[model samples]
Target: MSSPKILSVDDSRMIHTLINKGFAPYDVQMFFASNGAEGLEAAAKEKPDVILLDVTMPVMDGVECLGKLKADPALKDIPVIMLTAEAGKENVLKIAKMGVRDYIVKPFTEANVIDRVSRLVTLKPKSAAAAPAPAAAAPAAKKARIATDAIKILVVDEHPAIAESIAKAVSKRGWKVVPCAGPAEAQPHIASTVSSEETPDVILVSLAFPGKGALKFYQSVRMNPTLKGIPMVGLSVKTAIFDQNEAKETGYIAIFTKPLELGELPDRIARAMDLDITPIFYSSEGDCQVVSIPQDLSETGSIDLTRQSRKKVADFVNAGFSKLIIDLTGVTKFEIPLIRAVASIIHECNGLDIKWRIVGDDADNLPNLPTVISTNLKVAALKELPNPFTNTAPLDIYPTRAAAAAAF
Candidate 1:
């Protein structure tokens, strides 16, 4: 059998890149189109097994493209999943009337994307569907192989089966899983903790949890000073646009569609809690020195990341490296102190006549320093770097630090 073809229609090149990486492990052919018009053309020619259509686009939007697809005799039978930033009820009804197979909101995880795509397309072989092998090793060994510290997670789901499945997956990673049936049941767990370490590192609440009370629970948590920082992710059977919008508006770090991808739950938890599983590293690629930050810097233990960054920069400068690239793609939060520290470092780099650029999505969130250049794409950052001796302005400049400071 030939590889399944997956077509993605989006105006953002970053989304296209993410889709490619999310499905890289699977056995499938991926196609890309900038807008609905291009998507329609690609659909007719490729006849892709699955289409991931973005709702908002120039020239033609996803709804229009989906309408065209459903109307076409050859493409009408193909499955299409809607992707959008808006999850309003109105949008959901509009897409539902058009017959989309499923919908995924923005800021989704790689696992979320893969899980949804798998539901719509048969990318793997039947022989690869063997039952998972049982673990013969001790739980201690599993814990040692995974996390060094015990992670505590509070799971609130009305559905017993789904909650148990989620608990089982989290337990495999050596984390402690506390299962609660509803907001009332979960209250004790949240209130019992006296300190951050004692508290659940993260909470997974089902939107449909008994009484539709997950939002109430989220509000309560946010109102409490101690629990406010503890990230919460929503799980829901409702893939409708309105439900998604509600989940996001309720301030969930992410809202995943059920059934959850058991294997990917722990990683999602780590991301939601901003836990850094690995240490940041520095490497050299040709003429550029690349410093890759950890996926979650907020969990970097007792070490002062900002100070460490300063020392690293001093060392790099002393070692005669003129061009540096700091990769912050894995970092989720950009605190003001971090911004100030980075700005100071960039100022130092400027004094040393060193050229530098930062690659990450939160660059926009960073306080713009005149000395620093940032780009959402790594290649774009690298391409735009100017020679230090030329005294020319850096390319692809972001908003200035003054503007960011004022906004803050």
Candidate 2:
């Protein structure tokens, strides 16, 4: 198979040289552009598997260029990863909403760039060639190792041994696996899956494998909605300055190093889901550090507050996260058991070292009856007994649900 082509658009020749040097060991064809317009031109002609886009340029900045590339029918499917100087929350959210695969802040390490790109491309797979038709098989079906609708996990690395190890670790969790040698082969898979309704759930990628090729692929995946929500985790043996920053800037939920631990996956998967199920504990300095639960309680939707959740919440209160933030925003309708369970959590919090605060959007029923009924059991930190904390309270009515959540 031919090496995958990577289009790297940046004003800095140093970055281009660094990227090429980092990717030299991989099977990659490199393309460079000094500005977004030229980058677009190259992308249109080359139809490169992935494009590494720098956000700031002299003519037609990265954002504009990205819009043009995505809008064009012939080039839309190609993935583009944006390279920006500042990976601020606002900027990230803006580009994210605009559909960039991923963003790496400036001064990123070579490994960071490669790691992010590899995962995104592998998850989506794109190419010019048509897929081969499925062949006929025997009537007796084989019980598949992975379910057809299983959460797909993409593993990227040049080393077969490492890839196999990752596959073993992830398989323990009952996830489907797709392994690729580098970004070139990965892009076609990304494209095909992306064109369909079902996409991979998570991507585990190595930054050093395809280097810049990974960057381009990440860009493309971020732009597509089907692939956007999928979780990404980066793997590397050694962490560098840029590598750590890139992990944060590129929007990966977490980064892990090689000699992969099978046990750590449950926590990683939980974070990827953004469950807020992890408990926040106050450090000696009063800062917060997260403590993980054995399983994602949110995934199960309703957890019996019998022992485990009760203990976890109690621990948080003991550790000084007694200032509780319960998000009842999704819950308009509540059952009696759920209400009681919540009340139990609060009761446990109050007895511990911390003060519990019930912070959430306002309920539809003012002086909500369920809440009132459960008040004796409430143990959250707050000022008033009946009224939940509000910024500009004593309102004639209640603030909007969003407003209440923010205040609490």
Candidate 3:
């Protein structure tokens, strides 16, 4: 899951830096804006969970900015925190009526800002003050946590030391860790456990393992009902967009570089499992081919190929492309559209004349996609190919139109 993003809308670079640093302890992706207009734009693009607005700015004042943000239906749900030197009760009350989450007085302590932000981030909203007692107070009949349902985790790596390090770091967070020194060892463990009631919640795979080995691990882990929805995260010493692309196809949800700012690991892990704030990961896996759809699919190519991209995927039964290679070893959240598009295309291409296979996605992003996908596609590792094409084949999940055309 992407961190709970915060957009700091302040004319003062000092304040923006301060808020960001102070909240650094918490897992969050921070965005900065000098004033209201830029702040609004950032909010739309970043979809920040929280906004810190400065009252006085060169163009739009905080109050007016807050008004505009609340007016936009798309931005309204996001919590806004108005910051200013104004400590008057009247001023606070005024901003409060505008739906601001909380008002912070400038020249404030870092602790104050952190506390207020944390409170807002953790709270739920209500249409009216008198909304019925919260859901927690009225517990449901479902059993809360089954003993066998304890969080299941799989650690995949070629290096025993690294696998042990990750397992040690993550175990502190209360999740059960099952470490596999290589994908070969990981497969049977995952296969046997996946069909059980509670499957592993997370799989941390190292890309250094042989591509074929990694793919097999992901395939086994994802091909079962109990394990299908688990989120997989990749951990490696080297972090690159390419690495992320390679592992993304096999269904990993998030990717992180090793020597990992270890302190943040627990929080990131929690967020991935917590569906409310989870970020979407996009990958050109299966029948989902992430092309700059608006541009690559265009004739004249007037579209901004960089900003608005689309994925072209064949529906499950209709899919025919035979060479399947997915690179998800380095992927994070920006690739969600591609992931959804791939699933859609695969669904459309099912039962088609084409023989499809996949490579990469060693991290297990979409842990359960394989089980659902197996019904329609013949997924495999690039190394598993029987003939002709070899591992050297330049197949990227996020391929250029020319590259995809060449592959076809």
Candidate 4:
């Protein structure tokens, strides 16, 4: 099929620039018009697939332009999306009755424009058409993470409330959030702090900002040579695939949608920033180095466990710890990654001539144990394992942490 054609009729140069950036990754023919009169001319000449119309214009306002388009049988069929800053009831009602495809409020992200336009067109990725394919290289391994000090995160959002909520949630991990209203406020922040001790390690942006700030914020951030390599994360509504895809194209390391899954954000940041995390999973306890496994051993977490084993392996030897305790007291589920991770860590420790013992009870002490993800075969297989009460050989079974410690 031929490439889709789109036209934007906005007076603001920034909005036009933002729209272009939004569609930069797509295989589409873009047309621009500075005002309503120019939009009518362009729409007539190009017979575009869709038109993004602004409410207030010098020559002719959107209300008048839209009415004329609807009246003309040739152009009436074309989809039109209204771009407006004001959300007044009268204006909304007026435009609502006029049969515009949709309306996007200003201070929106490039993702927002892509999301709206994608509803009307099948967006084809421009990867092949835009750039020549390069030589393939080995996929980079995810670096082990550690948080020595606070990982400063810059949260750029229109709403301070949302940023504050995220701040409260992640503060426990020693991640500090610097909240800003928009790009304007964020500029000064980066200016003063980029080279300082408080430089941002990651940026979290709300794609649904108030006016037309998100796109501008992204542009300003990207324009800087120093910050070009910094990782960005897009925060958008869950249903907005286009926005998410746009973010992915623009090199956002992660796209977290609302309502945020409060559990996962920190992990993404940790991986992106690649902080040192040796202390999080392992600690020296008495004469043993205790490896505390998380309750839910996600695939990523399992991989991280293996990657992080390098540092603690030597630390135990250096500190003269004689025993390695695999503390699975908190683990309630059994997954392949978790099993593999434990086995790998055991091997690592074994290489150094250090002995390791697990500090966990049988099925009774561990509640809701599963062999893997809810498969009947796996569940049945797990059920056959002997409980502590029914075990024939009670070798190495520890009743408590004290018992485990005593055995070592």
Who wins the lDDT comparison? 4
Query: How many angstroms is residue 150 displaced in model 2 relative to the true structure, after the best TM-score fit?
Result: 3.7
Query: Which digits, one per residue and each the tens of the lDDT, describe model 2 over residues 14-80?
Result: 5676677556666678899989999989998888988899988898899999889879999888877
* Cα error, candidate 2, residue 307 (Å): 13
RMSD of each: 23.0, 24.3, 21.8, 26.6
Residue 391 CA displacement from its true place in model 3, Å: 63
**Candidate 4 local Cα displacement, residue 259, angstroms:** 2.1
Per TM-score, the best of the predicted structures is 4
Candidate 2 weakest lDDT stretch, 10 residues: 288-297
Per-prediction tally of clashes? 2, 26, 45, 10
The TM-score values for the models, in the order shown, are 0.37, 0.33, 0.32, 0.50
lDDT of each: 0.68, 0.59, 0.57, 0.73
Rank candidates, TM-score, best first: 4, 1, 2, 3
Task: Point out the higher-scoring one by lDDT: 3 or 4.
Answer: 4
| Candidate 3 residue runs with Cα over 4 Å from true position | 1-149, 192-198, 239-241, 275-408
